[model samples]
Target: MSKAEKTKQFIIEKTASLFNTKGYLSTTLSDIAQATHLTKGSIYGNFANKDELAIEVYKYNSGLLSKSMSRSFGDEFPTTMDKLHAFVDFYRKNWRSVFSNGGCPLMNAATESDDIFPGLKNQVKKSFEDWAGKISSVIIQGQKNGDLNEKANAEEYASIFIMLLEGGILLSKTTGDEKFLNLALERITKMIDNELNILPS
Candidate 1:
């Protein structure tokens, strides 16, 4: 990569956590400058403006999160149920990392951009749609493989999983306790076992 591209990436990397933790509206240009040790002009040169940078930062943070989850699942799990379980397990085992990085980027951006920063709403919306798509795809695969109920609604199941997980994240982060998320994950596992799993005759 060229020096300019590297600098742009460096700025994005350095400030991703800052934007996630501090928030897009509350985070100032000076804050980003301090975080990256670059002047406001340098930051502007790399990004058209603060709004543009915020969008890029959100993408960067979300991308990292996606990569982590993909790694957790890896290629070892051949079955759909295994992947779903791994999805829940990913949150259970990595809640700390998620929280430390300022909670899930989707949740953070969704709340903030819903009203405060309308500019980012589209990107955040796309991110959620993509996330749900991944989950639903897994369910569809399971149905094809006869590992999950053929009648099951993949989209519905995906929505439920996301709602439970995101709700768990919000509650746990608010209460400073992990029980909320634990309870949510427990419910999800039970749902998989009882509602979705297809037992052999």
Candidate 2:
């Protein structure tokens, strides 16, 4: 990476949490300068403006989450059921760590960007679509392999899972409790076992 690229990434890393916790509209160039210990000139040199920097920061934060989820289910799970279970398990164990870092970046950005930040709304939408695509791919592959019920709609299941998980995160974060997320995971697991998984015939 060039010096400019490194500097841009450094700024993104430093202010990612700030953007997630405080928000895009609320955060300012001065706040970023304070976080990165760089002058506004330096920041502007690296990024066109605060809006560009915020979008990059959102990508950086959300990429970490995407990679984390990928790692959780990557190679360890051989079967579709196992992969789905691992998906739920990842949140069950890592929700606190995720929350400590300012909750889910996708959720934070979605709520903050919608109808407010036009520049970021499209990016957030792409992130969500990509997430759903990953889960739907798993289910689609399972159906093709006869590991899951063919009747199950992969796209619908993917959407439902995301909704439940995000809703759970919102509720859990709001109430300062884990039960809401746990309950959501419980439902996901049950849905996988009862509704999606294929029985020996």
Q: TM-score of the candidate numbered 2?
A: 0.97
User: So what's the TM-score on candidate 1?
Assistant: 0.96
Which candidate number would show the highest lDDT if scored against the true structure? 2
lDDT of each: 0.90, 0.92
Model 1 segments more than 4 A misplaced: none
Q: Model 2, range 1-201, lDDT digits (tens) per residue?
A: 998788888999999999998888899889999999999999999898999999999999999999989775577799888899998899998998989888999999899889889889999999999999999999999999999999999999999999999999999999999999999999999899999998777
- Write model 1 residue lDDT over 118-139, tens digit each, in one string: 7798988888888888888888
Q: Lowest-scoring 10 consecutive residues by lDDT in candidate 1?
A: 66-75
Identify the leading candidate in terms of TM-score. 2
- lDDT of prediction 2: 0.92
Model 1: lDDT equals: 0.90
